[model samples]
Structure formats: C-alpha cells, structure tokens
Target: MNVIIWNCRGASKPSFKKRVRELVQNHNPAILVVMETRVGGDRAREITNLLPFDEAIHTDATSYAGGLWVLWNADRVDITLLSSTEHEIHAKVKVRFTNVSWLLSAVYASPRNAERQILWKNLMNVAELHNLPWVIAGDFNEPLLSEDKFGGRSVSVNRSLLFKECLDKCKMLDFGFAGPRFTWTNRREVQALI
Candidate 1:
C-alpha cells in the first residue's frame, strides 16, 4: 500500500488543508505523515481531522518549530504505536494489500546538531525491540555523503560518518530515490539531496 509523507512546512497556513486534500485524493495513501507542521494543540487536531484518515497520531510542535502527524486509513492499514517522541513516530503497521507487517518510523530529525544523535539512539532502541524490516522516512537533516550536498560549507564529514555508523549499527540501508538528485534548495537555489 502507498504511504505519502510530506514536510509541509506548516499546516497552519491558509491553503495547507486544500493541498493536503488534493494530495490525498491523488495518491490515496494508506498511511499519511506530515512533518514540520509548525502548529500544535487543538489546531493540530483540527488539521488531522481535515485529512482523509480515520485515525491519527500527533506530536505537538516544539517551541513552534517542529511537529509531526501520522494518519492512516483504518480499512487499508492497521498500525500499533511502538514508541514516539517529538522527533519521531515509531509504529508497526500491517498493510492489507500485502498481508505483511513491519516497523515504520516517521522521523523529523532536529536541525540542531546537538539533538540529532538522540534520534540515532532512538532508532537503535527500535532495532533492539523489533526484527521486522523497517522503513524510516523523513527530512533527517543530515546527508550520508559529500555528494548528497551542494552549495553548503562542505558537508560535515563527522556528521556523515556518525549517520553512517548509526545506519550500520541498526543494519539499515538507504532505499534510494528516483526524483531529482537535488531534492532541497537554499535561498540561492543551491541544492542538496538528504
């Protein structure tokens, strides 16, 4: 079953709901994750209700910066929450189409370097608990290689190595992507794929 995840930037904006509705109509994902919501409290709940899913889990915004919402169509997917924090939502989801069960971690790693390692630790904890194949997806805020970045202070070798180590320790591998090589851009249009 298809799952759509978006770093929508902010769900509080005027047109966010309409765009999400359109996306839900077009992709029809069994599970939907919206990150960097930039809103919390009852507003986050309102946005979740507006989406086309019967069930949702919300991680409130932290200091008005990062927020996460996980929504799923009850008929297409059954999910059990394993663990969660502001940085990630970890779950075991059973897809009806494939009749398979596995772990899903919807992560929004902190932009702050100091907080990134905590997320890595969280994944290691997840690995310790479940042996199922995993699918971790999000704007991790760190890239795996020098080639994954562009127009930045040369990418951090230390950060990249730490990311690699985390992946190795967790026995996880990149699923790779089919889109433009540069998936993100700066004010100058200099790009990076993370």
Candidate 2:
C-alpha cells in the first residue's frame, strides 16, 4: 500500500490546497501524514475538511508552532487511532482484502533535545505495546549522521548517538530515501538531508 508523509510546513498557505491535490493525483496514497501544519483548533479542522480524504485525525498546533494530521481513504485501509501527543500519533492500520495489519507512528519530533528525549521514550513505549509490523515516518528535525548536514555547524555526535540508541532499542531500521541527496535547504547556501 502507498503512504505519503509530507511536512507541508503550514496548511494555511495559499498553495496548500493545490499541492495536496497534486500529491493525491500523483501518488494515490491510501494514507497521508502531514506534519508542521502550523494551525490548530477550528482552523485546523476547517482546512483538513477541505482535503480529499475519507477520514482524518489531528493534534492541534500550539499557537502556530506544531500540528499534525493523519488522513486516509477508508476504502483502502481501516485506521484506528491508538494514541497521540503533539510529537506523534500512533495508529493501527488494517489493509482491505488482506490479513495484513500494522502499527504506524507518524512523528513530528522537536528540535529541542529535552523534548526529543520524551519523543524517544514515547516511541520505545509504543514499540513495546504490540508485536505487529511497525512503520515510523516524519520530519525528525535532527540529523542522525555527519552526512545528513551541509553548509552548517558539524553534526552533534551526542545528538546522533541518542537517536541511534533509540532506534537500536526499538529495533527499527532506517529505510532511507530515494531521489535527491538533500531533502531540505535554507535556500541561501545551506543544504541538509535526513
């Protein structure tokens, strides 16, 4: 099944609606996870309702900082929310016409080390909650290796170490990505990837 994870940055942008429609047409994903929506409450609800999804769940942003939405086409898969926090949303997804079921965690990790510690702990806890196949996806907000950064301060070994430990503890593997080596940039010389 196809799943699309996008850090749309802000759902309130003028082009947001058009961008989402394009993604839907191109990918035809069964599940779509949007991060850093930068909108919350009734505004978040209103915007999400306009998206072309059969169902959705969201965690509101804190005054335009961080927000998350998980949208899906019910005909493709049945999704049940297991739990949610500002940093992450855990759900049980069952594919139609198949016996396959899996746990999906969509994360919008904090840049702050302290807050990220909470995210790591929470992820570990979620890993222990079920034995089903699990997939975690999102903008982690921190690089895990030296190669993950460019045109900036060297990557912090301490930060990468903590993240590495967490992944090892959770028995999770990084599937990496395809296409460009850098997925992000400051547009002013600094380029980074994760």
Candidate 3:
C-alpha cells in the first residue's frame, strides 16, 4: 500500500494547502500521515475535507506545537484510534488488500534528551501491546546516520541512538528517508559541496 508522511509545519497557509493538494493529485497514497499539522478545531475539519480520505484522527489534546493527523481512505481501510500521549499518537488498523493488521504511529519526539527517552519508552510499550506489523513515521527529529544531515554535528547523538534502539526493539525498518534529503531549510544561504 502507498503511504505518504510529511511534516507540513502547519496546514493553515494557503501555499501549504495548495502544495498538499498537488501532492495528493500526484501520489494518491492509500494512507496519509501528517505531522505538525498545527491545526485545531474547525480549521482541522476544513483541512480534512480537502483530501480524498473521509476519516481522520487528529490530536485530541496537546501540550506542544502542531499536533498529529492521520487520514485514510475509509472504504479501503478500517482504522481505530488505540491511544495517544502527550508526544505521540497511535492507531491500529487492518489493510484490506493484505488482510493484515498494522499499527501506524505518528510521533513528534521532544528535542530534549530526557523527555525523548521517556517518549521512546512509551512507544515501546505501545508497540508491544499492539503486536502487529507496524510502521511509525514522522519528523523523528533525529537521523540514524551521519548521511541524514548536511553539515556540522547533527546534535543529539545519544538521542538518535535511543531512537535506533527503539526501532530495533520493535523490529521496525526505516523506509530509507525517501523524497528530499533535507526536509527543512534555513533562509540564509550557505553553500556546501558534498
């Protein structure tokens, strides 16, 4: 099944919506996982209607920036919101094509190492309980390898190590960081020859 995960930063912008629409038209993934929606209340509903998918699970409550949202083609998949935490969201569903159960998690890890460790532990517990083939995707905010970053130290080596440990514990595989190598860019131009 085709799945698209993006950190839209926020879907409130006109340009962002237009770009997302373009992506939908081109990719038409069976499931769409978005992070940092930065949307709330009626605005979230407005954004959901634009997509082909009829069902969505958005952040019920949050303590930080943009919450998570998962939209899927209702007819093709059955989704149930298992649970959600302050920093992570979890959903359990069965993909019709494979007749296999899967769990999809959208996570926005805290930048702080201590908080991130806690998040990692919580995720492991969730994964263990579900006991299904799963895919967790979002702005993990940490890259496993040095290749994931451009220049300078990537920061959070210990945190990145923890992320890797969680993935390994859950027996999950990285989808190979498809699309753009760098999802964010600074306004100031700094040329680097790699």
Report every candidate's CA lDDT. Answer: 0.86, 0.89, 0.76
Once model 1 is optimally superposed onto the true structure by TM-score, how far is the C-alpha of residue 100 displaced, in angstroms?
2.0
* TM-score of candidate 3 relative to the true fold: 0.85
| Residue-level error in angstroms, candidate 1, position 151 | 1.3
Q: Pairs clashing in candidate 1?
A: none
RMSD of 2: 2.1
Ranking by TM-score: 2, 1, 3
| lDDT of model 1, residue 12 | 91
Name the regions of candidate 1 deviating beyond 4 angstroms: 97-99, 189-194
Candidate 2 structure quality by residue, lDDT tens digits, 37-72: 998888988988899998998998877888999999
lDDT of 1 by residue, 69-139 (tens): 88999888889998889899999999876769989999999999878999998888788887898999888
How many pairs collide in each candidate, listed in order? 0, 0, 0
Q: By lDDT, who's the top model here?
A: 2
Candidate 3 has an lDDT of 0.76
Model 2 clashing residue pairs (backbone): none
Cα error of candidate 1 at position 170, Å: 1.7
Off by over 4 Å in 2: 189-194
Clash pairs detected, candidate 3 = none
